[model samples]
Target chain A: MGHVVIDVMPKTEILDPQGQAIAGALPRLGIDQFADVRQGKRFVLAVDGDVTQEHLAQARAAAEKMLSNPVIEDVVSVRVLEADGR
Target chain B: MGHVVIDVMPKTEILDPQGQAIAGALPRLGIDQFADVRQGKRFVLAVDGDVTQEHLAQARAAAEKMLSNPVIEDVVSVRVLEADGR
Candidate 1:
């Protein structure tokens, strides 16, 4: 079986409160010399066979409708990730 | 100048409650024909200039110490993602 990966990130133009929160915490935790930190979500879906264009489209649709909010999230990337079992 | 991507994923051996929840909800939302769904976190860090090996090490350390819990997490990947601004 193959896998499909969905990566969702907030739009740079939009205000990223969650990312800002993390950024605020980083320095307090001793991680200085850091720059902008943007947080996002990743989903890996295992399909029962080789990943196809149809599967990729489905994953993209799922990411848009189910995983991410359109207004705040600007970037969403979809791809196939092969498992180590093979 | 560059970006470091830290991807944290729950250990495959450990129970993934969050992913299970999503898998259970997908069919209800009419998103059938899906397979295993594993959820993770993605952090994109913007650095001032070109990425170096030292930066990658720092990112890895930050990911292990703060971004992910080693007990339950299996995979944490770090890399440099160049920004489009340059």
Candidate 2:
């Protein structure tokens, strides 16, 4: 078994309305020092079978294809936690 | 400076279409062993000023207020890293 965490975010040059709204609300919520907020999506996957390099590669491809909009999003970050090897 | 990581997830009882779709598509993408995928939100904040309990409290409040949907989401987890304290 293994756990994979993926983060998807809009490109830096693009305008993110969700992020803008959150950034605007930060000060009112008492976090005045926060200069910006970039909204993103996170996915946590629980694998039931063997964890292998091929599995990780497949997971990454799956994320790129359906989990995020690659056109607007510039970065896709993945972290593997609690894998069978370690 | 400090870094804060927040994870927000939908309540277990609620139906997560996004998660469902991803889970369904996993096998076709070659991640056949993934039993499920839970969609969530992650925010990484870089604090420029003092690192204090009050600052952490304020950041949490900000996340709850604008970054997460408290009504549908049951979990909000925060982790502080690279704080000035240590």
Candidate 3:
């Protein structure tokens, strides 16, 4: 089966409490290398055959209409998930 | 600033209600092309300097120790986010 990957991230101006909580806990884990953390959603949509332009268009439409909330989130990426899992 | 990306997904054997719900909803959106839907997480960790081997290692460590619940989820990918935002 072919798969399409869609990524959704909270808008830059939005407050991400989950990300903040993770960042706050990192130091306690003795991992001070990172300055910030942003949490987002990743979706894999599987299709019956090889991914085609039409599938991509549908995935894009789905990403916008169903996968993300436009007011608070941005559909950061919409692409095919390569066979080797890029 | 540089960034590292981490992806976490529920183990294949685990039942993903969210994914199932999404799959069930797709047809309702008139997006019946997709056969399955699996939802996961994407995390972007920001750092102040250039991304290095050490940072990658730390990201791997964090992904295992904190970002994912070993009992249910798997850390599928831990890599630099790249300058081009790949």
Provide i-RMS per model in Å: 4.6, 6.1, 1.4
**Local lDDT at A69 for model 1:** 90
Q: Order the candidate numbers by DockQ, best to worst.
A: 3, 1, 2
User: Order of candidates by lDDT, top first?
Assistant: 3, 1, 2
What TM-scores do the predictions have? 0.86, 0.78, 0.95
Local distance difference test, per candidate? Answer: 0.77, 0.69, 0.90
Best by TM-score: 3
> For model 3, how does the per-residue alpha-carbon lDDT over B1-86 read when each residue is reduced to its tens digit?
89999989888899999999999998888999999899999999999988889999999999999999999998988888855444
Cα RMSD of predicted structure 1: 3.2
Model 2 stretches with alpha carbons more than 4 Å out:
A82-86, B1-3, B49-53, B80-86
Task: For model 2, name the residue pairs that clash.
Answer: none
* Two-way TM-score contest, 1 vs 3, winner: 3
- How many residue pairs clash (N, CA or C atoms closer than 3 angstroms) in each of the candidate models, in the order given? 1, 0, 0
**Candidate 1 residue pairs in clash (backbone atoms < 3 Å):** B1-B48
Task: Give a tens-digit lDDT track for model 1, residues A12-57.
Answer: 8987777777777877767765688888988888889788888888
Q: Each candidate's DockQ score against the native complex?
A: 0.52, 0.44, 0.78
Better of 1 and 3 by DockQ: 3
RMSD of each: 3.2, 4.5, 1.2
